[model samples]
Each structure stands twice: as structure tokens, then as C-alpha cells.
Target: MRSWKRRGPTYCKDTWGCPRSQRKRVVFNKFGQPIGKIGKKFTNFLGTVARLGAELPIDQFDWRQVPNEKKEDAWEVVQDYYDVDEMHKSWTLSNIGTKWKDWKCYLRKTYFDPGFPCTDDRVIGDQWTGLYAHWQSSLAQKHSITNKANRSKQVMMHTNGTQSFACKRYDLEKGSGKVLSRPELFKLTHTKKNGKIVDKA
Candidate 1:
């Protein structure tokens, strides 16, 4: 397993907030791109109403809004506000607070065990990859980091003053995966056209 994870960017210049991370996510994807780089910053809730009418021109009488048609350009304001806006609003609202993981998990790419010369010529890598961890694994449990500095490192805190890292990893394996749910697995097996797999598990 890798010993350390590269922390998030110190600045927003590298990858803009929420878009890159939530691009694959539904709620933010529907949000229209920020006008003049001022994303989702509406002048007011009524302003949002005005913009939606101006953009979609949905007639109250006809009520002809279609599915997935406006998905990419849907308004976050609309989605978060009206119950009719989101497809899964009920589910989202139901899980307002919950504990997810119970232990920390790490990953490292290597050809041999610890203390071995990594470049040993005999060493080789394999494909068909997945992580190996038991049922209760997390990258952020037990550690108490309520201090401001640790929170700056993306540490999550509870009301009880305990802390945990906010990091996450994909259990690419198919079955018996912890936190397995509706989301697809992050599996990368074969190399692309000319890419090489230096190491894999």
C-alpha cells in the first residue's frame, strides 16, 4: 500500500472546486456553469427563479419538463429547493447524518515485501487489480484531530471531539467490498493504447 496520499491542492488554480470532484456526481453536474466564473452564485433565490424561467421557459400551464433533457443544465438551486427538482431528493434528505467507516486503509505499489530492493530485476507486476481489506476499513478512524491544523488537512470531526481523515479509496474488487453501494467501482486493469502498468495488485 502507498504510505502517503498527495494532499489536495493548496490553491484552486489546479482544479476548480466541486466540478472536477463532482463532475461525475449528479447534484453539481446539473448546475449551470458559473457566469463569468461566478458559479452558482445567484443574486437571490428569486433571481434563480427569474433565471430558470428565462432559460427553460417552462410554462406553468403545459408543464412539459422532460427527464435528462435539462439534466446537464439543471439548476442547483432548483434541485436543492423544490422536491420536484431532484430524482433522489427524498433519499438524500433521509441520510442527513450517518457514520460510514471504522478503520484506516492504505495502498502501496511494490514488487516485493518491505526492505527488499524495489528495482530487483526479477520483480514483476500483475494485472486484474483490486484492494485487499477486511469489512471494517477506513483511512480516517480513531485519530482525534479536532484542532484547527488537522482540520485544515481535511480531517473530519464528530460532535464528541474525535477526528478522522476525510480521505477515501475505491475497493475495486467486485464482491464483499466495504461501503459498496450504487456507485460503480474504480477498476483499471489493462493499460491504454501505449501505456504501461509498472505495478498493480
Candidate 2:
């Protein structure tokens, strides 16, 4: 819920020849990391491509033949050539909900915390154990409390919708008593681990 005031007229001075004044920009923040700005014109162009049901025309780009300096210019020309008004007509931004916040917070905590097990090994222990341990360690460090019951309660809430046997241990420890889908658990763990790798790599 932040707003940005335009500092000056937007203009494209680069080789693409897009009118700079017509550009619109949106900025996004995921957790604390800034995703940066995306121009309305670029988004519109992508929408146009989608509406036209056309694959972006990159067939002419032969990587081996194109010189480094000229390759950028070639891409711009290709992008501009495919830009059409029809794509702009279908473009709209919609809210996708905030279900990702807990996961994002967990990842940020895991990445920044020194106690996280994966700091030494790229392959963390079994996904559930690693994530739960990270969460438990983070809470313990942050709150300075050693009560196992309190830690288990936090883990249950944090690991909701996760179905690993480790998650069951967490649930039983917390005394909430519920089960979740194994496939869903696997998907969540894999996706988060992959994201961590991508971020570090």
C-alpha cells in the first residue's frame, strides 16, 4: 500500500524509440526485498502478445551470428515489432492474496539466521526437519524462552498444511492432532528449497 509520485516525465531515450512520457511504472515489495519497477508499456506489450496468441518472434535471433552490441539493438527491434495495441486492451492487475507471507517470512528468517542448518550444506536435512528446526531456532533465539510446549505450538501454526512425519511430530507435540496431504508438503518444501538455491546462487 505505497504510492510513488513521478519525479519527471517518463521517456525512452534508448534505441527502442518508445516515447518516454507515456511510460508508467509500478514497484512491488516482497517481504522486505524490493522487486523493483516494471513499466506499463512493457507489461502492455506482453499482454498484447498474449492476446494475439503469438509466441514472441525470436526466431531471427541467431546467437552465434549476432555481435554483442548489435544483439541488444536486434532484441529491441524485435520487441517493438511485435508490440501491438491489442495486447494492451487485455492488461489488468489483480490482487493474488497474501497467503505467501508466512512462507516468505520463514525463508527470510532461515537465510539470515546463523543457526540455520543449510548454511554448511546446500542440501538441508529432510525438508520438514530443516524448516521446522529453522522455525524453532528462530523463535527460541528471538523470544529467549526454552519452554518446549511454547515452541511446539508455534511450530504447529507455522507448519499448518504441511504433511511430513516430522510435521506430525510437531502437531502431536503441540497436541493439535491433525494431518495434511503429503504431496502438498513435498511441493511446498521443494519450491522453498529451490527458491533458496536460486537466491543464493
* Runs with alpha carbons beyond 4 Å of true place in candidate 2: 1-18, 26-61, 75-201
Question: What is the C-alpha lDDT profile of model 1 across 117-182, one tens digit per residue?
Answer: 334221121210111221113431233233336658753222211111111112232234665332
Per model, state how many residue pairs clash. 7, 5
Model 2 TM-score, all chains together: 0.18
Residue 33 lDDT (model 1): 16
Off by over 4 Å in 1: 1-3, 6-87, 99-201
User: Tell me, what's the RMSD of every candidate?
Assistant: 22.2, 22.7
lDDT of 1 at 118: 36
Q: Per-residue error at 34 for model 1, in Å?
A: 22
The lDDT of each candidate is 0.26, 0.34
> Of the candidates shown, which would achieve the greatest lDDT relative to the real structure?
2
Q: Give the clash count for model 1.
A: 7
lDDT of 2 by residue, 21-60 (tens): 4434433222211122233334333323221101221111
